[model samples]
Target chain A: MRISVQLKDFDIGKELKLFNNGDTNIGAVVSFHGIVRNNSEKSLMHMDIEQYPGMTQKAISNYVEMAVERWSLYDALVIHRHGKLLLGDRIMMVATAARHRRDAFQSAEFLMDYLKSRAPFWKKEVTKDGYQWVKSVLDDESALERWR
Target chain B: MIKVLYFAWVRERIGVPYEIVETQSGTVMELVEELKQKEPRYEIAFSDLSAIKVAINQELCEFDTKLNGAIEIAFFPPMTGG
Candidate 1:
């Protein structure tokens, strides 16, 4: 398992190659990539992602541990970027490997859902109007209830 | 002294990222009340407790949680990561 919080852009193809590692028992590998959307009222100029440095890694690792246990996953990888990003840039990615497709897919979705609400990162959107902190959506909070 | 940290707009409203607070409060709620009385900025930033979340020693915790020799506490809005 791997969890990376960084400012530099990541290569998805390279990350996938490193995750596989010729493990024959891994039958399915599922990945999800979050991207910055250009949905601001005045068009998004950029986004500043702020994070609690010490807590971010620990929080994510806890979720990854849960995913591995609940889904019986073979391996998992999470890479989330901090600092500045423009619209359409890759924000983060999650990859899950399992013996079957079901576990891999479900674990990846679970990771995304938890990451959205539980992680310490906050986003400030900069648009033509000005800067504004993005508020947490009610839908995101409700999404966690299903897992409980 | 407890190291209190703020993030996102909480930091902006408080005008600082973190501060060292010395207080006699026994719980996080009492500590918050003490802070709210310090300045209007704190009052405004923490006006809605429902919108805020607390962490003690980098772990998510409840407002009623005890201080208990904790070295760090953080207050911030709900996370919007990923």
Candidate 2:
């Protein structure tokens, strides 16, 4: 398992290749990407992501452990970018590998859902009016609860 | 002593993210009331319980739950992650 929370750009192609490793045993790999979107109603100038260092890593690692135990995944990769991010920025990526598609798919989705609701990261949007902090959506919480 | 954590708006409003408080065994609500008495900043930060959510160690929990041995208590707005 590899987890990275940093302020650097990532190449998906390179990441996928590294994950595959030409290992025949790895039959399935699932990946998900989260990008910054430009909305009409709220033109987001940028986003500032804040996190608590030790706690953030602990929280993410714990989530991954649960996913592996629950889904029988072989390996997983999670990368989340921090600092000032503009429109079209890659916010995060989750990849899971397993011997079967079901394990790969379910683990990938579960990892995303867990990260979406429980990750200890705060996003502040720089809007036209001013910097506004985003609120937690009810649906996000409900999505995580569904898995439990 | 339990370590309390505030995040995002709650942290900004409270002007800090962590505090170590000495308290006897009490419910989360009792801690909230005690926090409100600690300072005006906490009072304003926790004024709307409906907007805030508590977590015991990282799992979502209710404010009325007992905090007998909780090492960490986290307060934040509804999770808007993803």
lDDT tens readout by residue for model 1, B1-82: 9999999999999999999999899999999999999999999999999999999999999999999999999999999999
**Segments of candidate 2 deviating more than 4 angstroms:** B56-61, B69-71
Query: Per-residue alpha-carbon lDDT of model 2 for B1-82, expressed as tens digits?
Result: 9999888899999887798989884899999999899899999999999998788876668999999799999898765555
The CAPRI class of candidate 1 is high
What are the per-model C-alpha RMSD values against the true structure?
Answer: 0.9, 2.3
Which ranges of candidate 1 are over 4 A from the true structure?
A: A40-42
* Predicted model with the maximum lDDT: 1
Q: What's the TM-score of chain A alone for every prediction?
A: 0.97, 0.94
True-vs-predicted CA distance for residue B29, candidate 2, Å: 2.0
lDDT string, candidate 2, A9-70, tens digits? 79888998898877677889999999888756757899888765566677789989998888
The worst-scoring run of ten residues by lDDT in candidate 1 chain A lies at: A35-44
Write candidate 1's Cα lDDT for A25-121 as tens digits.
9999999999999763758999999999989999999999999999999999999999999988999999999999999999999999999999999
TM per candidate, chain B = 0.97, 0.95
